[model samples]
Target: MPYNIPSGSQSNSSGVALARSQNWAFNPPSIDVISSLHILQAQPAAVTLSVSIRDMLASSLATTHSDFNLGITLVQDADALDLFALSSSTHTISNPILLDAAVLLSMQLEVAFVDPTILLEGRYSGYIRFSITATNNSTSIVEEVDLREYSLNLERTGSTTNLLTPRTVNMAYIQGGVSPVLDFDIIPAAASSGSLGYVLSHQGDTVVTLAGTSTSNPPFTLITGDGAVSGTLALDTTIWDSKSLGIHDTVINAIFPDWNVILGMDVNVAVFNAPGAIVAPDVLEFSTLVPDNPQEKFIDIFSTNGFTITAPPWILLSQSSGVDSARIGVMPIDVSNFIQGTYQGMVVITASGNIYEVEVIYQVNDQLETTIDLMDVNFTKDNLYLQVNGYDFNHFLQVESTIKTYDIAGTEFVTTDVVRVPFFNSSARYDVGEFIHESMRWIKDPQAAALGVLDPLSAPARGLYQKLGFVDFNLKVIDRRNQTVRFIRNLNGTKWAPGRSPFNDSNGYHFQNFNDAVARITTEGFGIINIFSKEASSLVLFKNNVEIDSFVLNGGDLPSSRLLIYGGNYLPGDIIKAQINYGTPAIPQLLEKFFVVYPKTDYSCHFLFRTSYNTLEILQCTGKILGFVEYSRQSNTVLKNGVDIINHIQTNRVDPLKVNTGFIPEDQRYMLDVFKRSLAVWLVVPQYTQPIPVSIESTELSHSDNDRFLHAYDCEFKINRDIDEQIYLF
Candidate 1:
């Protein structure tokens, strides 16, 4: 066996040369396009480029450079430069030529093609014209040929690929136990018909096994079936694991009949883990969707292996149950009931014995007939009570009103830009000069004279009441909507603040308003101060001054309320200070105040809810509006004790005001009552501390066509500030 040798060699005259292999049956006899030719002033000599010729039918036919003419012409625009000087030019072969299978039986010829000194800064093209004849050692001419032409392009100024060949392989990320077939293509700087080979290596101690390859040699010659070199590489990743994953880089070299071109590739052997699944849309959020509207959103579930995944019940599957292996689409059921408010839950997915919880939140917005704020005013008799001491038997009064800006979108109006009216006081006086001086004295403390019982006149009545110079006995508060509220004295003098201590005033201290307006409940004539009766039994409670009772009664029944000595001794006005325990207390445990009522003692000075038990102050003094109310779902950071745990979705709502929608006909009176019975029943059961949607309807005295008008729904109400809790049971 004879060692294989290339048929061409590099010419000493700074040029490139390629010869076709003598294994003519394995390769076709043709000319390849000379893609790139470069001439530089730095080069030593005129560049010579050449081609080869051989006898394909007679494998043992002898060949030499003298038997062929190598002609090259350099052309720029319409100008042509004769590079070969003459048509018949030849190059000398370094190795001996033998006409046999062991030898390629071919000759290579390189001409002094381009004059490096004469090369200008412009694009120049050329053509490789080959003429050859083959003969046997007996001197009998076997084949002859005229000149054939192929294009050759050259450049002197712009970036040239003459120094670099761009070769690239597809990125292979193969999982363990799987094989990936990668393909690569090389664009050579100079055109040639050749085969390619690769040198493979691993990064670490991982050993990679490659198999199922047809390439026989590292310096493999390409079999240009149709003038392109292409093949597939099979990589096995079964040996990869957590600790021994493989990353192999391969250097691919194109073995031209003469020169060699090298390129690199990076491979990654991915570790195959266990069987599990992944789901898109980790969170499913549904905006204001109409009730009874068939709305559906899809979620994609995929698994690594062909394992079956179990969907949660709320997530309505298009098919019977779960799916296996493939990516399946699932949607949630439409909200069938016509109940307005936020509904939250989760979409649970169980795959390969693993459970995944995806949070889902949705809200149903109500259609409204009007878009204005309606006043639901409640006047507490005792709240208006003004006491008359020894000064002409005239009572003192003060009123504060909060005018606010609101953002109205559809039917939802969020309060903002709260401007509180300057504190006002009203009282009757005789002498104009003395009245002004005495009025300023009462603002410090309205009960200052009474506080100093030993000498009442010695104590100055300096308080907020005297500062406003109330000329009349009656005080009034007007809101931004021009709704005027009057405050008259409680003639019976049943002050809710009964026990007034001169030494340590039990008077309430004021606190700044909350970031948002919250729900507040108020009732009148139910019961007096420190009264624990059925009417006054049901009371609203607060926790951390935030969780105020949105519902005064639950399930048509009042929450269980009892009077027990909470923090301190039961003073006359201790009920106003002590915490009011709510919910059914089976065996009333004597614990400390668990539910801290809102508007704590601040009702006396600051604006408060109407239900508050304050004599000089009307309880429902709306506070300062900070910003626009946001109707969107808010993500809350859940905390356990002091550490952060997870995120939760929360919604907000405000208390509703009653307003008449429309009136029914006289003949429809009985029919309207019957229709209310068939309507959906609303319940106020707090689920996961979230506000429950409730409907309160009543027939008004106004009638049209003998039918009474009905007022239902609280459109002004806002949901709780924090409503994020997983309601889905898996």
Candidate 2:
């Protein structure tokens, strides 16, 4: 039977039931990752719950949002409270929400359709909400109501992808101890022991949970004894031997004692007070063969008595003192600046009133002779399998970097784990774009977004294109072949926009592509033309053999990627000429005119050739072939009849229209340079002329540039008619 509304004259006999009727806020979810918000409510009767969940377990980028609001109603009838010990009832979305493999959340929310008139007939008033767990389900969700049935207006910004994950929540750290005391700000202080229930876990951030009930005598009701409903719990985990290294987490599902419905949840993590120990190498050693190459080593430190480190004047240490599980980096002050020699120092450590000494050694070894080499191949394509090929390579550590957070460039520098890519022998190749793309996933910048709208790069980072601009890939290969550690670096990876691809799903546009001039272009068939390079380089452009403009850039040595490509209004057959001059001071000197894009005409075809030479050229041919009838003015006026002399006429043959290469560059001896296996050639442009198929007449390719001119050994694309030419009219 429906209970009458309580007035000044009417009151419930049970104090526990009356207190729940008055208290508004409910406990949160069991797993720390999933949070709850009240979306619908008919005070003391029911509440519509929107469950906000955070998921961090991801191997790659994904776009999706999580589940529906749950509904819960308290036992308001005095008769029901008197007859049965019922606290609340679960309505739609009544099934337990499984958080992970183990952790499950019972009754947390509800939007009830009851006899009461004010049952929150509308949807959530504020931000749009949906029902679904972020975790892929074991079964389909039971949809009890059509969302539009309530006639509510809601707008979703794109799809909720990468919005609630890849995030690190700053949480409070508590030291793990036996019989540890815990305090909570439970709303209305959960009045009685019968009002709450819980579940427990040995781990923390993994949500660190599963389901069922825990019988640990951890009091959530008045453990402090100061107030009747004090939110204190002295977890007497005599059986849970949790005092060790790392974090100890617990998952508790707060429920209505004997009911199947859970009113709320609680999760807590107690960090380990690193057991005192001396975790350090007997000696710290650093050595390198390359000049100015950085070398690094680490020393682990964790002490309950607190610790302090003292190093020699020349030795550099990351931290002088610490009290928890941490790794302190030991590096040389100036290995590159100093000449090839051996330097030594000492690192003294004190912990738990005990002193230990570590011998530090730094050596600048003579350049070692090795076959491992980082290829000097320049590419504009993204994520096309690339590698560092050589003898004896087991693993690789690719360090991706970007601009500083506070600097004008607007980015941050980040490091990677050496062990993540373990090197047993040294052959390790990583995806340059994927690494660059992954680094930008972190929101390290503190800069705020414009207006009230959050910065796209700020928290809740969504989309593939991040706020930070570019990433410079520097790979370090640790070759441990000869029972010794040797570091080889492949710093030639100069990929741009690590967080971008050729086509973006959100923007629905073609962006990056494989255009050699668009140096940063990597995506297939989508490139930005007539754009400037991100590096500083020299380029001169001409149109129709007329000089347009010249940019002679220098001074800024590093690859700023600021170089621009402009062809002086480069149009089809515009004689777009270019002279490119760029090289680091470390590389040999060179200044050369690259090539010219020639005009297109009938009977034309292009070929693609890639080589080490600096010059490029385009070959073309035009004019008509003729056939003459027997006799005519050249011959005698023969074949003539009686009265007059007759003449013969010549027939003109029209050429077929062909689309061929516009430019090519080859070395002077490239014609006979058959010994070089590095040369590559392809029929690059205008490949789709249907009736007249295009094919290269010669396999031997050569080129002529301003520097190395070679006119012969040219590979011209000859058009083969798929079907015989039906007509060649004059």
Candidate 3:
């Protein structure tokens, strides 16, 4: 049966039944007819809907369609188109297209197509246009795009090496712009023999050097199947000079002989640096001869240059001098008592080069003794003391004393008192008893020991007495008239002067009394008073008598008092005896009244003005007074007649005038006139009279009867009137 199909669907109108039918015809079939029929029927429905993504390229003047130019590219040996191809839509047209149509359509196409069969063969070659254009339609345009594929092969080159090795051994590369980078294992050389190698090639013909010339070389070590062997390389030239080896040597030596022998004296040896190499010995030895006796010794040394062995000058010959150089010498050679013996000492030599030592010995024969002076001790008290010197002397000394005593009558006595003087060191007490004993021993008289002695030659003896509370009361050296030396010592410490009481009692001895009545006058009030005595005889009475006067007496009135009868007048060749009274009122009181008498040969007067009324009635006189008499008192009316008497004498040169009725000396007439005038003024004149100025002159009178008579009348007038009467008398 044969079947035929028609296009379009059959439709039926209303009310009419429509049916569609196919006819089948049977005939002898030809193969060409069937094949031609199949080809014609598949023509439109078999059209492929292939959509490719490609870069669109458009410039100001041109546009490119590159979808048709897309060709199969391989990526890492796989078909790139296959990456975008859906396996389920390989031959069917029902699947959605995955390719980007806009990017493909915008690209400029170069070769419009690639044969699919060639892609199947893994061989592709095609061109696509990439157009770059400015948005402003500018003419600057570039139209090329490079297409690249990445093929990576990871590998390690050569054998495994330590990580510390330098990276300059193996290398890697990629061809046709393939990025070639690979990570490899860093295996130790002890574990691996070689590293894997990687190769990358494009289409097999364009081969890149497997060990790329541009790639960095990886570090590696060569392994001999055991351990790694480090590659030997040339050292850097910059550091070659620093590596070197140094050698050094030091040498020391003793230049002198090792053994030196000396008989009985100091010996010296030297040490020095040797010419060539020489090592110092740990120990050095020296030799010397032993002497028959014992002695002190020393050793001296010299320097390398042999300079006379002056280092540490004069090495001690004995221990007393201390140690010095390296030489040996004997001192104070007393070897006769010593057995045959060797005396030795060591000398140490030290320097920066080395240290060494040597021994020295010597012998000697002699005698020695030590001596000290005895007079070198300094005694504290030199006169009566003795001191011992040196370490081997006794300190004690023998002592003796001689004493003397004398009575007031000058009788002397003696006594011998022996005593021992004790020795004392610096720390002991000051021996006062020793001082007194020594002082007494030096005294001239033994009886005076209790009374004490005066030894001017012995300062220590004197000092001893002073220390024991003895005072120098009578240290006198007097040459008496009998050619005997008289020394007076008043141990009672008494002194007296005229008019001073020597005892504490009132009736005790009086040192001086100028008047015989002073004893009676001062007996009731005789304690003490300052009295003036004019002459030495007056002082005798004040010292020997006990009376003193109460009336104010003058130096001239003592002779009239008769208390100073014998010595009242001081004469030449009279020795005045005096003493200082220190008891009772004290010595200073007696000295107040005592005065040295001087002779009054000429007449002088001192007149004191008592009244403001200066009257011409009294006539001043300058002469020695001979005598005086007192007159009876009278009234003013009666004294008025006395003024007439004075007027009578002055007016008339009459002898035996009433006022001059007495036998007046001719020189005394003027004075009698003055007296009578003063008496009249005193008795008859009214009170409160105005004063009249009067001149007073003191003059020396000639030693004549006339001057003497005038002086006598003046004194008599002064004695009759009180000082207030304005009377001038001398």
Q: Pick the candidate with the highest TM-score.
A: 2
Best of the two (2, 3) by TM-score: 2
Q: After superposition, how far is residue 574 of candidate 1 from its true place, in Å?
A: 33
Predicted candidate 3 versus true structure: per-residue lDDT over 1-730, tens digit per residue = 0011110111110100000011111111100111111111221111122323233233111232122222223222233232121112342223222222334432111111211222211122111111121111222222121111111111112222222123221111111222222222221322324522111111111111222232112222121212322222211212222323221111111111111110111111121223111112322222111122222333333222111111222223332221112233433233334443344544445422344454443322111111111111111132123232111111222222232322111223232222222222211222222333322332222222222222211222221111111111121222212323222222221111111112232311122231112222111111112222222222222332333322332331111111111122334323233332323544332421332233432222222221111112222223433321212233222222122333221221212111112234543343333333232222211111221122221222233355444323323221211224232110
Model 1 lDDT tens row, 1-730: 1011111111111000112222221121211112222322243333333344344334322332224322233222333264332222433333223333322333333334444334433434444433333432333433332223333333344224322122322222325544445554433344534532233322322223234335433332333221233445444333333333222344443332212322343332223354455555687655332343323555554444423444556555544334332234454455656377776676666655676666766655332111111111111221122221111111112222111111010111111111111111112121211212211221223232132222111111111111111111223222213343322221121111212211111111111111112223221101112211122223443334444342232211111122221211122222222233332488542212321222222111111111111121111212221211332245432222111111332434322323232333332233223223221221111112111222334434432332343322211222233333212110
Work out the TM-score per prediction: 0.17, 0.22, 0.14
Instruction: List, residue by residue over 555-604, the lDDT tens digit for candidate 2.
Output: 22111112222222244333444444444558733333223333333423
Write down the lDDT that model 2 would get: 0.31
Clashes of each: 30, 44, 51
When 2 and 3 are scored with lDDT, the better candidate is 2
The candidate maximizing lDDT is 2
In model 3, state the lDDT of residue 220: 22
